[model samples]
Target: MNGSVTSQDLGEIFKPIVESFGCELWGIDFNNSGRSRLLRIYIDKTERPIDVKDCEKVSRQISGVLDVEETISGDYVLEVSSPGIDRPLFSIDQFKMYIGSKISLKSRIQKEGRRKFNGVLKKVDAQNIEVEVGKVDYVFPHSNIESANLISDY
Candidate 1:
């Protein structure tokens, strides 16, 4: 699969493999950068912090599966690592988990005459999320958000 494959499909393909090793499949980012594509998978565990060993294990296992199944074509980098402090939020559930935390995001459509926003994540439900940017509260639909990540100042 090239750029045609959706991240959700990739997530379904990898979630079992990631969870088998006792980790949550945080998200998958499939980027087509000119000649080469990038498939970055973020993994996390509820019990402990992820380390190089965790990444290595996941990469090694996932690489074997991908090779055997031919899930991806062309030269692409397969990265399996932790989301780090500034973890990219991919789903509403992920957004819910980070409520009350600082976040920065860019919307696909303009909101309030701007596309970029930085604020404390105040609320997250099924359809949208409310973020407090200073004194203003901005609501962004799940579909409108292009990219979002936690902001860890510490």
Candidate 2:
């Protein structure tokens, strides 16, 4: 899969299958690396942590579905796993959940001469999020965030 295959597209195709196994589709990461593409599906459960069996079960189900659907253009590795403690933040709601927690993120475009930010997520509203990096507070539009992950202090 190339640029044509989006995370959203794959998420739509795989979310139902993931949910069927009593887990939530935390996020999907599709990396197009020339001939060797990698597709990673992150699964989560509110009550407890996901185990190897959960990963195996979801992997099998998704593998079968992908084989049948043929949505991808070429050969790719499919990995199903939990979004660990340093889990990626994909949506605004996901960010909201981490309020007052530390996060490391990269912005698509530089803001105030900086594109990278590592600090506590101070606030989240409808359009933007505030991060307190050092003593300065920076407000970044949600759309500008290229990638964000919760910081595992441990």
Candidate 3:
């Protein structure tokens, strides 16, 4: 793909590949920073926990496809793995799934005079999610979220 390719574009491209392996494409994180670039793909399986074999299988397929499609320019490391316990939340559906769980998120822009929030996920809707930090509930539009991740109870 081109430099302009968004995460959503990569998601659309890989969703089918991931599904063919009997897995769900949980999310994709592409970090292009400094001299190195990293493309991280998180996959999930409903039936069982993901293992190294699964990651290797998906990695091989994705690597081949990326090579043929030139999906990413220049040198980049491709990593395929599970989201883990402190899984990063990518979609609104993910947030919905983790309702009532502790989460921390960073917004692209300051909301209520803060860009970072650590709280209990109270509610999720189509457009927004409510997180209670301390006793105050904060509503954040989905578009404003830069990154969010569950706070592992462990």
Candidate 4:
């Protein structure tokens, strides 16, 4: 993809391919800051736990499409995998799915001198979510979240 291409664009490009494997496109993470760009595709299947074979299958297909499309201009590492236990939450709907679960998140901007929060997910709405850390409740706008993931006990 070009510099103007966003994760959303990548999502559109890859969603069909992922779904063809009987998986949901959980999310896409493209990191270009490092020496080598990394494109990570997270896939999920409710019917069964994803295995190595599943990832390999998706990777091979995606790689072939990427090569043919030349979506990415330069060399980049492509990874296709399950979200695992501590799955990253990429959408408001995802957060809603894990209500009452423990979660940790980093915000793009500090709130009350804190940029990181680890807490129980209390509530989720269209615009924001409420989390309880200790005895205090914090509300975070979805737009401010840089990253968030469920906190797994296992």
Candidate 5:
């Protein structure tokens, strides 16, 4: 299935496998190298950090499943790791989880010729992510976000 399926489809296929391991599957990145490709699987715990052993175990399990099913062919590097400090805010739940924490966002369409915003994440409801920038509150639709990451501690 090397050329048959897109990464999105493969991600959908792998989501359950990762979730079954008691990890939230943050994202998957596939980078093609000259000799091999890098398949990085980012995962995390909802309430705590993941350790090296956790990553290794998930790696082994995922490797087995990938090898058997052949999601992507050719020599590849499979790396299972944590999402780190700037974990992505992919869903409303993720946004809610980080409320009261500082965040940065970029949208698909520019606003005032700027695509970025940095502020304390206020609220994340079914409709949007609320962020307070300066003295104003901005509501961003989850669908319009091109990228979002937790702001690192100073």
Candidate 6:
């Protein structure tokens, strides 16, 4: 099918399928080209970092399943790999996972003149994130966030 399926549905379909093989599904991006399509899967694991073989294995297996199921009914390339250093903050758990680390959060709501906030992740509550700014902590609602990612330290 359709990509309009619930996020939970897509997650359900991919989670077990990937984790069953001992891999964490990082992301799934379904997009269109001029007349073609692309299905990219980003994966992760604990031990040995994702190498070529790891990506190959996941790509091959996932490709086989997607091919037979025909969820994407068009010409597409399947790409699988690690999240690298700059991974997307997907959930509250993920945000919690990076507490104390630097992050860049952007939302529709404006504060001081922009929608971006750069600060340390102080806390990741249920529906909002508390970021320490100056002497005050600003709570940002998760639903209003357009995107969030870790700020690399180098």
In order, the Cα lDDT scores of the candidates are 0.92, 0.91, 0.93, 0.91, 0.82, 0.77
Model 3 TM: 0.96
- The residue-by-residue lDDT of candidate 5 on 1-154, one tens digit each, is 7744555776787788888878888886677556777888888887779999879888988899888988777888889899888876667777877889999998887776788999899888887888898988888888788778898996
Q: Which ten residues in a row have the lowest lDDT in candidate 5?
A: 1-10
Best by lDDT: 3
lDDT by residue (1-154, candidate 2, tens digit) is 4348889999998999999989999998888668888999999999999999999999999998788777887888999989999999988899999999999989999878889999999999989999999999999888888889999989
Give one clash count per candidate, in the order shown: 0, 0, 1, 2, 0, 0
1-154 per-residue lDDT for model 1 (tens digits): 6557788888999999999889999999889568778899999999999999999998999999888888877778999999999999999899999999999999999986899999999999999999999999999989999999999999
Task: Name the runs in model 2 displaced over 4 angstroms.
Answer: 1-3
lDDT of 4 by residue, 1-154 (tens): 5655678888998999999999999999899666788999999999999889889998999999989988888778999989999999999999999999999999999988989999999999999999999999999899999999999998
Against the true structure, what is every candidate's RMSD? 1.3, 1.6, 1.0, 1.0, 3.3, 2.8
Name the runs in model 3 displaced over 4 angstroms.
none
- Indicate whether candidate 2 or candidate 5 has the larger TM-score: 2
Candidate 6: deviation at residue 152, Å?
A: 1.8
Clashing pairs in 3: 1-71
Native-structure RMSD, model 3? 1.0
* lDDT score of residue 150 within candidate 6: 86
Clashing residue pairs in candidate 6 are none
The candidate, 2 or 4, that scores higher on TM-score is 4
- Each prediction's TM-score against the native? 0.94, 0.93, 0.96, 0.96, 0.75, 0.80
Model 4 residue 2 CA deviation (Å) reads 1.2
**What range of 10 consecutive residues in model 3 has the weakest lDDT sum?**
1-10
Colliding pairs, model 5: none
